[model samples]
Structures are given as structure tokens and as C-alpha cells.
Target: MDVSKVRKDFHILEKRVRGKPIIYFDSACMALKPKQVIDAVNSYYNDFTACHGRSVHYFSAQTTEKYIEAHRKVERFIGAKENEVVFTKNCTEAINLVANGLKWEKGDRVITTKMEHNSNLIPWMKLAKERGVVHDYVEVDNEGKLDIEDLNAKLETKTKLVSLVYTSNVTGATLNASEVAKICHDAGAMLLLDGAQAVPHMKVDVKKTGVDFLAFSGHKMLGPSGTGALYGRLDLLKGMNQFIVGGETVKNTMLSSWEAEDSPAKFEAGLQDYAGMLGFGAAADYLMRLGMEEVHSYEKKLARKLYDGLKAIPQVTNIYGPSNPEERSALASFTLKGMNPQEVALILDESANIFVRSGMHCCHLYHQDVIHEMHGTIRPSLYIYNTDEELDKFFDALRNIAALA
Candidate 1:
């Protein structure tokens, strides 16, 4: 994949910390933006800093054109129709669109997994609390792999939806979306995939998976923040209710009566992030040019290197993820014996200029209920721009920390 050349595209990689070269290993939280994405966002503010789809002036027209083009680019990126894509502030909002938009009757059931991030879990729990809807979770094995039998057992005729994470943010274990989708559909339930971790690291085709809805953020994929999308089947979206109201979301409004726009526009309300959308489209284009399959292959190679390196260290204990590199994403989460996760993370940053995530990673329920780790695990996430030398440095830092313990 010529990672050295790829590294040149990101300006943030050149940054230094405490007079030493910075080693970034926290792509799961937010990926570093490339110059192409930065330029695309800058051009929007520089040339056409105007409201989209609200005026007929030159700036507005240009902004509107780019905005619609961004939708088209994302549609192509995820193998969805243009009308099916709805832009949201982030992935959390995208998921909430489906959560709040759907009509939930009392006793209606929704199924999820323990491995989901808080963004995916909290909304459904809110539904259960405020409304009369029921929410259930599928079980995962010790390796953080979902139990298909438990998922099947949870599905019932009253099951309204099965929402799950495509990849675990903490453990890096990936779900078989197609299989899960089939199970949900067979039981007369719709499937929604939280693709925040999966979309950035792998090729995801919602059509191939037959999922009713998909949500992901652009910030985790080398794009700007406040940019994300929701892809829903046209038929399903047409039947759902609008989440937010006012502005472009409505077709016509009389004193007390209003008609909402169709599909995508019906969901998007108020002024959108025009600049962020352009950057998101550019980020998708960058990944497409490089090829998603190639990106996935390269990341898996690096993940295996990191996993094996961590395993070799005697102080490293309770490594949490799939043992097989092919079954996991480009990250690993583990805990060092006799050291707090936060302390280890601080040491790595202070001594080696390394950046990583430490904590439950917003999966507190999973950490307490499933893994049973109170403090949490040290997570080192990777991307295409990362190199082998960086992994070597990470291992060296860990070894030094281990000696002190």
C-alpha cells in the first residue's frame, strides 16, 4: 500500500510532541485528516461560504451543487441510492434518527449486543424507558465474538429491530452483518448496523448485508467532524416518521398543518454543515482511489504485528480481541498487569510521545458485565498511514513500562 507515501498525505503526522516525533495510535477515536480533505473543506469556506438550497445567488448555487454532489459521493461510497442518504451531525445523530423516527408500540422488542458503543446502546435504552418498547442484548463469547445462537434465541415475532455494532471499538471483534441481517429478517425484524468502526477500516456494502439501516461518522474516516450519514432503504424511510422538523424538512406549511419532504430531505432539518460535507466526500474519494480491499489488507497486517508484539511481553495480560487477525479490525485493547490503564497511557505519552485511548472506551456496560474489567483496557488503534517502525516504538515503550512494574 506504500504506507510511507500515504503518511505524506496527512499533515498532522509531521507534528512533534515534547521535542520528539509524535506517534498517533488513536484512529478509532478520530482519524487524522489528510491534506486533500483539508483542502476540500478550505475551498468551501474560501469560495462559496453561503447557505445551501435556500437562495438563487452564485455562492448559494455553488454551495448547493457541492452539497448535493457530496450526497451523491457518499451514496456511491456505500453502494446506496442518492435518495437514501441523509446527512446528520454525526453517527450518534444518524442512529437517533432511526431510533426516534420509528413508531414504537408497547411490547415491541429491539435486540442489540453487549459489544456496542454507548452511542448505539443508550438510544434504545431511552426508548425502553420513555416508551413501552422492550430492549434485549445478545451474548458474546470470551473472545468477544457474538453468539449467533443467543441472537437467534433473542429474536421473536414481536422483534421490531436488531441494531448492532459492525466492529467492536474496544475489542476489535467484527460481526457477520449478513448473517445477523438474515436472522433479523427471517424473524420479521429490521436490522440496523452501527458502522462507526467498520466503515473506516473496511469495505461495507449495505445492500450486500441487506441491513435496513446503517450509520457512520466521517470524522473516523479522515474527514471533518460534524459530518456523518444514515443510509436506509427507500421503502423503510418512506414509512418512518421525521426526527427533526422545520426548514428544508417540510414541503408545505399551513397554520397548523404541515407536510414533510420525501425520504432524505425529510430527515435533514435546518442549515447543514456544508463545508464538512465537502470534506467528507473528499475523504470517501481518497479511500476509494486507494481501494478499500487494499486498505483492509494493510490494516490487518499491522494489527497482527501489534497483537503479536503485545503478546510477547510477559507483563501484558488480558488482551481483549479475536485471536485471529482476519476476524479483528486494525486495533487491539489490552491491560498491563499491576498497572492502571490510564497510568500506562500517560506514561506512553509522556515518555515516548505516543497517543492512545485508555478506559472503557464508552462501553462501560460491556466492561462491567462482559469482560469484568473495572479500570478498562489500553487501546492502540492503527490506520493505513501507520508504519512498522511506529509499532516497534510502541512495543519498546510497553517493555520499558513493564520493567518498572
Candidate 2:
């Protein structure tokens, strides 16, 4: 990939702070948007601003067409049918849709990993509290990789679902989805992958992985916020209960009764974010044109460089995840020996115009129980738009920071 050309696509890269060019290393939180996505969002508001699938006016018709097309684009991106894609506000809502909508019997078991984000973990915990559902967490190794043996040991005949993160937001460790899916299916359970970190960095084929359900956010993939999707098997979705009721989710309603719409529409209640959907579709198109394999290869190369550079620093300690680039995404979470994570992040921003995440990254269980880091680690996440020069600048800043340590 042409690094300089890719940087040009994101206008945010031109931004300056503290008399220096901004070095954004927080893509895991939210990616920087490209001009193409921005234009697509603007076109929706400028050319066609009307409610979708509710009226017969020209604006409504055009808006609905774009909205439906966006669904198809996302479907193609994730290897799912158009009807299988249900738009949600974000990944959190997508996960909740499955957690709440699924028919959970008393004492039914759900398996998850210890390293999952709060969005993935809290819903199941809530279910266990409200209903008689059983929630179990698989163990993670020191490197933050999920223990397959522990996962298998946790699985039982009563296991209803095995929901896990495709990639760790805290450690950037990528999971073997196909292997996990096979384990779940062999144990007579369904697999649901939280793909918020994986989908943006690598190619994810639901069919190949044989996942029963998948959830991801568009904002982390160069799209607008308040846009995400859930992909569920058609048969499962048809049988599952509706999450939110009212409005476009239903086809017809009487005083005493109501009939819900088909699969995708049944899950999507009320007015949708038409502009955000268009921008998400455009973002998917942009990534497809570049090719996911190429994107993955480029990111791995950058990640390797980042890991090697950080390891060479004497003050840097306890770099999380696998050392191998192919086993992880383009991110490195670590800590300086004596400095607080938040303090280091603030210094980087104020002195070097660098933006990095510092905290537990919402995986409180992993931080509190697994790693036992009370403060947290400094996380520098990368994307296609990030360049080597930016990494060099980061290394320079780190070396100076190390002197203090």
C-alpha cells in the first residue's frame, strides 16, 4: 500500500497540536474518518433527508434506497445475506440485541473469555442476574491469549452460546475464530464473535468461521459513530424474540394484536441513522477497494515495527499480547517502569502532540483479576493511515520519557 496516498484520504491527519503534527495512535477507540465517508454522510443530509421505509415521497424513496443499499454493502463486506444484517446504534446495542432477544431458559450456560470488553461481558452478567442464566469466563494466559483447553473444559451440554472477542481491545491478540466455532458447535452450542476490533483490521468471513452471530462497530472502521451491525443466522433470528418494539419493526398492528416485520426490520425499531448508514457503506467500500488482505499485511508489518521498537526501550515493561505480529493486530499496550499510564499519555499529548489511550480499556475484569494492574497500561493503536515517521516520533518521545523513569 502507498502510505503517503492513504494518509491523504484522511483530512484529520493534517491537524496540528502544540506546534507539531498530530500523531493519532488511538484507532482502537475510534478510527479517523476519511473524506469519502464524510462526503457520503454529507450527501445523505444534503440530497435526501427523509425517513426510510415509512413514506412514498421522492425524498423518502431515495433515502430508503440508500439505506437498503447500505445494508447490502455491509452484508457483502461480512459475507452475510442482506436480511441477516440488523443495524444498531453501536456494538454494545448489537450484543444486547442477541443477549436479550435470544430465548434463554433457566440455568442455560453462556461461555465467554476473561479479556472481553465491558460491552460483551456486562450483558451476559446482567442476564445471569435477571434470569437463571449461567455465565462462565474462560481463562487467559499471561500473553492474553485465550486458553482453548479452559474453554473446552467450561463447555457443557447445557451451554447455549459461546460469545468471545475476535480480537482483544486491551492486548490486540487475535483469536482463532474457526477453531472456537468448531468447539462451540461440537458441544452443541452457538458461537457469537464480538468483531469490533477484528473487522476493522482483518478480513472476517462469518461463513468460514461458522459463527451463529457476529457484532461489529463501523466507527472503528473509518465510518461514523452511532453505526454498527449484528449478523445472525436467518433461522435463528426468525425464531428469536424482538429486542425493541414499535414503528418500522412491525408490518401491521391492531388494537389487540401486532405482527412484527421480517428478520432485519424486526430487530430495527424506530427511525434509523440514514446518514451514518451511508457513511458506513462508503467506509466498507473504501476498505474493499484497498483489499483486506493487503490491509492486514500492512498493519502486521507496522505492528512488528512497533513491538520491536517498544521492546528495545529499557523503561518499557510488560508489553501485552503475542510477540508475533501475525498473531496480533496493529496495537501495543505497555507501561513505563515508574510513570503512571495517564500521566504518560498526558505528557505525550502535551509535549509531542501524540494521542494514545491509557486505562483498562473497559476490560475491568482482566485488569483487576488477570493482570492486576490498578492504574492500567498505555495503549498505542495503529491504522492504515498511520505512518513510520509517526512511529519514529513516538519512539523519540518514549526515549525521553524513559530518562525520567
Off by over 4 Å in 1: none
Q: Looking at model 1, report the run of 10 residues with the lowest lDDT sum.
A: 321-330
lDDT, model 2, position 78: 91
RMSD of each: 0.8, 0.8
What TM value does model 2 have?
0.99
| lDDT (Cα, tens digit) per residue for candidate 2, span 246-314 | 899898999998999998999999998999999999999999988889999999989988998999999
lDDT of 2 at 34: 94
* Clash pairs detected, candidate 1: none
User: What's the count of clashing pairs in each model shown?
Assistant: 0, 0
Please give the range of 10 consecutive residues that has the lowest summed lDDT in model 2. Answer: 11-20
Q: All candidates' TM-scores?
A: 0.99, 0.99
Cα displacement (angstroms), candidate 1, residue 25, comes to 0.4
